[model samples]
Target: MITASRVFLIVMGLGFIVLGLNGLLNPLGHLAPYGLDYQAPGWMGEIRANYGGMHIGIGVLTALGAVHYAWRRNALALQLVFLGGLAVGRTLSVFLDGMPPTFALVFIAIEWVGAGLALWFLRSSN
Candidate 1:
């Protein structure tokens, strides 16, 4: 039986895999969103492309990695830190962009809770 922690990790990992693939496959549209900023550096477009691909690639790899790190109980520290970082980024985005209440709340819900769950699992595993 999957423990509660394992369940959370699996769900979050799957979500990351899906979102990352979507971004990776649709580079210009979904992945390269930051490249469109006027304030972006001259090399930002290239950076954006590379970073987006890398992020997506990492996400995909992590999704697979989570099976061991998260689900099967290995590398919990690294996974915790990664998830914490993601949550922080997402939290910061809400403030910087100032999204609508519902949307912002939804993002907040995902970030804080999802990341919290992952972190909790990591901590408990130790």
Candidate 2:
């Protein structure tokens, strides 16, 4: 039962889990390179809650989708929305705000690819 979908779910889930944990444990170190810094104490809490908690939840749910048959489609849908949303937002920023950092450009490409894969798997499974 080691389908590509399962592998993708596991990989993406684990990746998000790691990222979430990093964001939680070291928000500044994790995001400071991206020009995001804590302007106030509340900023740390915000990043820890939104980026850390939300991503951890996403990761757990995604990994669950891999192991639970009933969750597969829903999990794929989650990937589509999450990755697609990021791509859309970033793309919009490029048009409205002009070019961003090279890293952001790279992230946009990766998010699109990930969203495409999620969509492909979602459709193929139907």
Candidate 3:
């Protein structure tokens, strides 16, 4: 039977995969809510390659952690790093640029929650 932590990791992995695909396939639409509007093709390409690829990589690692005991710790570490970094960046933005949209706030919450889950699991295991 799968534990709650494993289920959380799997769900988080799937979430990242879906978001990554959306960013890769539709950069403009994916970034619209973030107030990012790039007119140049190069900018759009960069967004698709960088943001989308990053998320996809993280998703794959996270999913691997769910199935591979050897990879669980490392996968959780990666998740913590990625989500924590995002949460930090968002917090910085809120301080420097003022509050963002509701959707952005929602993402911040998700990031923090993901980071917290990863941290909790890591600590409990140790």
RMSD vs true structure, all candidates: 4.4, 1.1, 1.0
Give the residue spans of candidate 2 off by over 4 A.
none
Model 2 is weakest, by summed lDDT over 10 consecutive residues, at 32-41
**Tens-digit lDDT track of model 2 for 25-125:** 88898787688778588998998987788898999999999999899889989999999999999999999999998988998998899899999999999
Per-candidate clashes come to 0, 0, 0
lDDT of 2 at 102: 93
Q: Largest lDDT belongs to which candidate?
A: 2
What TM-score do all the candidates reach, one by one? 0.60, 0.94, 0.95
Q: Which model scores highest in TM-score?
A: 3
The lDDT ranking, best first, is 2, 3, 1
Model 1 spans > 4 angstroms off? 31-52, 69-79, 93-97, 100-105
lDDT of 3 at 71: 89
Model 2: residue 46 alpha-carbon error in angstroms: 0.9
lDDT by residue for model 1 over 31-57, one digit each (tens)? 243444333455445544554565565
Tens digit of lDDT per residue, candidate 3, span 32-99?
98788995989988888876877888888899999988888898898899999999999899999999
Q: lDDT of each prediction vs. the true structure?
A: 0.56, 0.91, 0.89
- Alpha carbon deviation, residue 122, candidate 2 (Å): 0.7
Q: Candidate 3 — worst ten consecutive residues by lDDT sum?
A: 49-58
